[model samples]
Target chain A: MSEPNTREITYLEAVREALTQEMRRDPSVFLLGEDIGVYGGAFGVTRGMLEEFGPERVRDTPISEAAIAGAATGAALMGMRPVMEIMFMDFITIAMNQLVNQAAKIRFMFGGKASIPMVIRTPAGSGTGAAAQHCQSLEAWFINVPGIKVVAPATPYDAKGLLIAAIRDNNPVLFMEHKLLYRTKGPVPEELYSIPLGQAVVRREGRDATVLAYSVMVPRALEAAEQLSREGIELEVIDLRSLKPLDQATIVASVSKTGRVLIVHEAPRTGGFGGELAAVIAESEAFDYLDAPIRRLAGRDIPIPYNRTLERAAVPQVEDIVAAARALAQEGR
Target chain B: MTEFVPHPILDPAVIPRGSQQLLRELPKERLAWMLQKMCEIRYFEEKAEELYVRGLVHGTMHLSIGQEASSVGSIAALRPDDLIIHHHRGHGHTIAKGADLKRMMAEFLGKECGYCRGRGGSMHIADIPGGNLGATGVVGSGIPTAVGIALALQMRRSPQVLLAFFGDGAVNLGEFHEALNMAAIWKLPVVFICENNQYGMSGPAKVMCAVQPLSVRAIAYNMPGQTVDGNDVLAVYQVTQAAVERARRGEGPAFIENYTYRWRGHSKSDRNVYRTQAEIDEWKQRCPIARFKQLLIEAHVLTPEEVETIDAQAKMAIERAAEEALVCPEPSPENLEAEVYAP
Candidate 1:
């Protein structure tokens, strides 16, 4: 598939197209979850999809996450690649038993005899006023699991490419899409092209402190990196598309050149992806070349509030990353 | 040397002798094969009890001690392409499906040679290549999984049936309700084998279960439900064989409850205080192996001398498996990150 015949679309359209193409390509591919078919998905991401894929492929299931996950696992075992939607990331807790105990362990338990090639596509993050129950960032939860792959794509291009890859991959993948990012637009090729899971893209190149981020924070980090460039302190922003594999090579390369690192993410400071990046940098050969101890700018542990003011305060703003980068640059190791 | 012998014991009230006659009518070789399979399970479980007492196996070990008949009978009916999800007490199901006993025993010991590289111990043994998708420790988790397998089978128009082996306790789990609803609505080819071992942990079937007969719950789902003698291997086999045939013919799922009892505690650490010792002895009197052995003797299929050879063979096979599993190397640390995702 090439970009010549393909047209550019919004992140939402890109995801829809990817799913539609995959469904058409494979008969065994089907969707299952609550309010997805008739309701066109909870966030309307699957709008008009039910008519296209029909009731069989774009299925509307009961409000049971365990049922959805367990069914997906079962289907995968029987040679069907299923794409299951979990409306809210928070609700994944209800189905953790199937995801962790069954989906993750099935293949290994069978000594590689079984493969659960399913994707759990869920909307996450706090920008929307969906509040406490709906807007928590739980990527860290899936990242902790061994058998499943955790992926959160920031751009429309990556969203389409990564999802296609996830469906084709012969393992369970937890695909987390930020709630606020669905409408965001980018140049996604009409032709199919899959982005590998564990690779990182250099969103912006600079020589000062390296800023490693993922998901919604990647765009924000790149924006901050541009603003900080005019202040004479250039920053390198690395977008970590896949969290579990953690694309250590790109982060290590960027940090080695700059000698100072500042990791930014929307997840809370305690035990977040930033901690994982920091640990990797500290343990690697890049540790000896650091000009300053790696600093992390992440969200506070407080619950995301409904109020605009409180919600903004709960997550990492562009100013937070810029400030963290400046402070790290000033304090040399 | 200790002489190996098969002792015939009986209580037809638990398992009727007529079912054994049906088994004999089936291919004689097939009947012999089924009996050998059940014997292997009995020997393995007995060894597990011994190892559990010695503290070699960590975590609670759920024994399929008395319910071997139902496990072997149901699995024997499935084809190579058909899928099965076993319950926590799943050793019999795994072994019946052709899981290598040495590797399986290693899994119980949490050694690297275990199927999951020691990640999942005794409660979650799996070998999906042989159509054994694996078992879950969580009650009723496999119900939806089996439903999903059937759904896929239906989508592919493949004549493959999915089987889920659960205990009577699973009927109480909410997932069971959701799974049954899905299976009924789609009319998927799934066989729900409920080994009604009379108790969930220490709670008796009569006290904990609100429903009189657990199989009756299937009727509400618009599926056929039946109750069979779980202690009688042949009886379980006959009913389940019919159910499997129905599923393969696309007649939809069937709920079959096999009434049976476990001869030991729920797990090794269970203090036998919840039930009286007399109750335990009563169920022990209806042991599946004893009843089946008596049928073989009465029918002249196996003589006292021939049965003695079978017992010796079973013990030797189990002992060999134990030795091989004991010496097998643990999974290398590098392999820990290997199977998480396909490369």
Candidate 2:
């Protein structure tokens, strides 16, 4: 609830600002993770925070994902809002029990006696050429869980706003930051503000087909829609900022208008979140309005290759989205 | 060591020299309360076992029947405001941390008035308001969470300590080492107590363990570690007392391995193929409740008559709780999705 900064900043800077502002606004909010202190995090998302907040608030911890996640869960139970950076989303595998079983289920298991007010921030996606070990989109794992919330912000504006919202949310939240989206600059208000979770923002409105996306895929969907607009084909692109408390109303309304759907994500297709989105449409009133079968454009079911060329082919690209959107848009015509 | 069997009785020489005199100097009322709580836990699980065998309770449960001293003594050392996190076999931890007996039984019976509103059964019952954060079905899950609570307390500069309870099985988990190492480095105010009942399911810790005592792993973290006769209530209390006080003083975490035994099989589904009935019978002869009763009588903290009266009261209390829990309304399916996330 403060004034926003008028200047433009990168998505990574926006995330740091949110952490800085939240820690400043509330004493209970703190940051902890490996290399977050002096090293400024593995990707520099928390660079200047250590100097400003000191070691106590900006804790540099051992590389223990389980402890990092479990510590956040415990601290949240004690009424402290802790933000833990997992360095890479792929490393979250080591901490899944704490993330899925303990942190996610604590509130419900305790009958609402406690709420785990914690955030797990990890840089995700396949563009970094960091290979299968570091580059992968696993947001679907957190979304599959019942108690935790998942936030995948697309722009600098959403990155800051959703991070603030996630910190204030009285539940475990997994915040996915695409490695490529970090440097993309956009207008962000410097003052304290929050974007409510589960609210979808329609980046582009169209009548031909609806493009559902999140995280890094949102921008690609927007660019794909931009490319097709010249051919009189307009694609509606909806960025699902929050995954668990899904904005089904927005998704349904978009699909109802367009009568076609194209779900895109960086994760492999076999059991990715696209399947859940497709099921949501098929099971809802949106199914009645469908003009064509829903199409899913996702990563192939294989380990991400370290080779730059194969990595690009392993996940969806702007070209991939353009082709997928073009096909879905012209299917019924 | 390959054959799983514990000494039928405890060695009196293993008791710490000044601990009994420390017991004399301690509050008599607290000792009496611990005795009563231990009895209540024993009877509570016995009743729960009876129900599960009768097809009344839902799902399988892990019983800490032979490990009551480890729960009661460690919890007894904490201040009322201090927090705790329990492992799956945690009825004793919940009860010792001052949960409502009737409500606990209601949870076991899957009633709406239960702790988790029947959403969580035996392995997940919690009493958060009363300082028990709850338990998870997974082994060693609570270790890091307990350290996290300690980190919170450290940030707030709170004197409150977190007493984390787990089993011998949990000591082998990756999270255990990670959590302990972090706790030591941060000097977080927490006490990690391992209820080493010797088996993780059918696999005996004696065969699986690389170290003699589970607490020895704490040395890797450069934290204090101790192994105590968990059957001796006073001994558990003594070791936990030092660790709790050390944590309150911000000296960092301590690990205490309570060498106890679980008289029952791991759970209802266990067929007892791993251990013999002779071993079970041996542990039964060294029941924590009976040992505590003898300790109290000799120390004058409680008389033989007083111990029996407490035992009777505890048994009656458990029975009354069971009766009330059995008739409580079943939880409605409506609003089942409400608690999945906080509003």
Candidate 3:
């Protein structure tokens, strides 16, 4: 077949297209969340879906996160693919028992007789002035869970593809989206397509140093790589779309070739997903090729502040990634 | 707000308890089967307790000894195709729902022949084909799940109903209220059955709940709510039947709080520190099995000899199951990682 036609679309539009296309393709797939029906969701990611699929398919649930999560799990157990949205990542704490204890453990605890085919889509990271309660990156919490697969997409292309993969996968998936990436547009295919869950994408190719990033940090890492390229310091940017089933091969290959690594994320530095990536690289054969100590540039170990300056300071900016990669590349010399 | 008056349907002192008129109308064979099932549950729990004490069973097991009527009656009210979501103390509920006796025993014994392949011992037993969605160890965690199941059923316009069984402790959980309100607003075909066994672990219900009747809380969700004498099998059966019918008719969810008592302490570790012996004796005197048996005999539905024969048959079945479970092989570690996800 000829190459599929493509067009530019925002990350939010891509997410909606994926949901609409998947629901039309599969009758069992449905969406549920607080203000998802007529309200089109908190971030308008599910706009027009209610009218397209009607109220049954686009369920507007009560302001009960536990019920949304638990109900999705239950529906999944009963052979329905439910895509639930938790308006903000911070509110996920309320439904932790259902997602972590029940949904994550059901298949293993039930002797594998049941498979929970469900996806929880939520907006994460600190950029919007939503403050401490709303602005937080909590993907690290679910990455540690065994049965659940965590996916964080940076661009519209990956967002649509990865979400389709998540909806179709026979496992509970945590799909984390960056609030700032909603309006960001990218070239996306007109037709439906899916990117494999665990495969990492090489956004930019380089050999001087490797920068591992995901979600919002991906664009930032790419920006840093551009600036670093002018200074004659090349940085390979690897976007880990899937966290649980980590693309260790790509990570190892990049780290080995570059001989230096810098892990970046919008989450806190301590106990963040960056630490896990660092450990993975260190444990692999890539450790022997390390020219400098594996560095992790991440958000500070504090709640995201409301002030834009402080919020920017709390998380790693493009400049921070550039500086960290430049210093790591220089250390190799 | 309505006053917290105990539902008259649940009053123990109500006249015509286990109504002979109702018993007279029921088929003799059906009555015999119900009595037999209740006896089997009682005998199975007794044997399980013995096995636990003898160190044959590994983990702590929750026994539904005196609450057999509540388990049997509510389950008996549903069609075989109907679904049930159970709480931690759901062994009797499983048995009442017609789970294989040998497999259940093997599961408790951690044998490969168990329903969950020895993974989910007692608290997490499930029989999917048999319509038992399994039991949860977490209190009230399964309530919202049941609502979701009901929603799916409603969406498909299936004639089936889902019953979510939890204890009085679960009613106090936020999930319970959320699920009830959702089920009520959506008009999902579900029945929320609260087997109020008077205590939650070591805490008494009086101390935990603000309302006298837990069913009263259902009124806040705009659903029909009632309390029933849990020890009266017929009462529990009739109330559950009404709720099940209402759900089947698409009239929305209904809540039934069965007032019952557990004869044993919570799990194998309890020493009965929170309860008095006199209280236990008083509740035991209201034994559901004995009450049902007396009702059957007084109504001439079962002769004393037939009742003895049924008891003997149930005991024999339990013995055979225990023997089969004892000989079943332990799960091999070769495929330990299997079933963590769908293949």
Which regions in candidate 1 have their CA more than 4 angstroms from the true location? Answer: A1-3, A326-333, B1-25, B51-60, B100-103, B106-121, B296-312, B323-335
Q: Score candidate 1 by lDDT.
A: 0.84
Model 2 lDDT per residue over B1-343, tens place? 5853222112233344555786777788898899899999999999999999899987778899989999998898889998888889999999999999999999988899999988888989988789988887899999988888999999999989999989999988999999999999999999998999999998899888888767667768888788888988878887788888878888888888999999888998889889999999999999988888887888787878999999999999999999999999998888768888887
Candidate 3 - CAPRI tier?
medium
By lDDT, rank the candidates, best first: 3, 2, 1
DockQ score for model 3, please?
0.75
In order, what are the TM-scores of chain A for the candidates?
0.97, 0.98, 0.98
Q: Can you write out model 1's per-residue Cα lDDT over A224-284, one digit (the tens) per residue?
A: 8888888988888898898866788888888999899998888888988778889999999
Instruction: Say which docking band candidate 1 falls in.
Output: acceptable
TM-score of each: 0.90, 0.96, 0.97
At residue A237, candidate 3 shows an lDDT of: 96
Ranking 1 against 2 by lDDT, winner: 2
Q: By DockQ, highest first, what's the ranking? A: 2, 3, 1
Q: For candidate 1 chain B, which ten residues in a row score worst on lDDT?
A: B4-13
Ten residues in sequence with the least summed lDDT for candidate 1 chain A: A1-10
Best by DockQ: 2
lDDT of model 1 at residue A322? 80
